[model samples]
Target: MDNANTWFDYIPFNSRGKVGKISVLLLLIAVGLSDFVSASILKPYFERLRPSHSELEGLILLVNKGGKYGFVSSHAANIFAASTILSFFYIHKKKLCLTIAFLVSYSRIYVGVHFPGDVIFGGMLGYLIAIITITFYSKFVLNKNKKKLIG
Candidate 1:
């Protein structure tokens, strides 16, 4: 197949237009912020121990123990943030994005790294961050530059 005008020609997937490129950049920023909040701020403040570190009688850790704290799983936060932002940009792939985020969050628990509450809170935090970021993008970035992007 001729690859001259393929969709992947841009820096990001399907980002042929300025809006798409901006969306991708915002998505990345959202995910990064989510992970930072979960891993650096909240986790340190809460200081909850990972299941792998706790002495659960029957706990069988699939992976090595994680850091000192696990109040919020960064993996869950990052994935959910990415998924939520992607859903905003690609409405048709919302289900797929959410499913992937759910699976990744669940794995954090299944592997005995995070508790159910950790994953839940992480997902919520991620969703909140994504929403805030997307709203900012829509209001400031997209709205302000609508004419430039469209024209």
Candidate 2:
């Protein structure tokens, strides 16, 4: 348990390193863009309502933002996407990245604004997208510049 807690503790300070800080910033930007595109634009088009506003009234009403249509959670999507990209870049600190990701995703539920299912699905989707994006960028873009950096 102590070992587990240690990893979580490291997450908040992982960006202390110059390279790690740069990686974190890049991941944050990528995640933010993805979340904005999905939640702000896509959700409106889909027009799905929140669980609380749905016909089923028995569910827990976490938050009542007045405006319904809470299909995908922006918080979940952003945090999970950031986590995925950070994990790929900082493979040595994968556990810390995952822990931070989980906490960020959970915040949406704790604060209201998104249903449990919405967060889960959004997180999964964001993670998948991040993985593909990171993999391709690393292979094509970074690989081409590796020699310059090393030399």
- For each predicted model, how many residue pairs clash, with residues at least 3 apart or on different chains? 0, 2
Q: What C-alpha lDDT values do all the predictions have?
A: 0.86, 0.73
lDDT of 1 by residue, 20-104 (tens): 8777887889988998899889988988888888888999889988897998889988998899988887788789889999999
Model 1 shows how many backbone clashes?
0
Superposed model 2: Cα runs more than 4 Å off? 1-18, 64-67, 106-113, 147-151
TM-score of decoy 2: 0.70
Record all residue pairs in model 2 with backbone atoms less than 3 Å apart, i.e. clashing. Answer: 48-69, 49-69
TM-score of each candidate structure, all chains considered together: 0.86, 0.70
Q: Which stretches of candidate 1 lie over 4 Å from their true place?
A: 1-14, 146-151
* Residue 136's lDDT in candidate 2: 72
What local lDDT does model 1 show for residue 32? 89
Weakest 10 consecutive residues of candidate 1 by summed lDDT:
4-13
Residue by residue across 34-134, what tens digits does model 2's lDDT show?
A: 78766788689878786656676555655556457777877777778888887777787788878887888787777566678878878887887687777
Top candidate by TM-score: 1
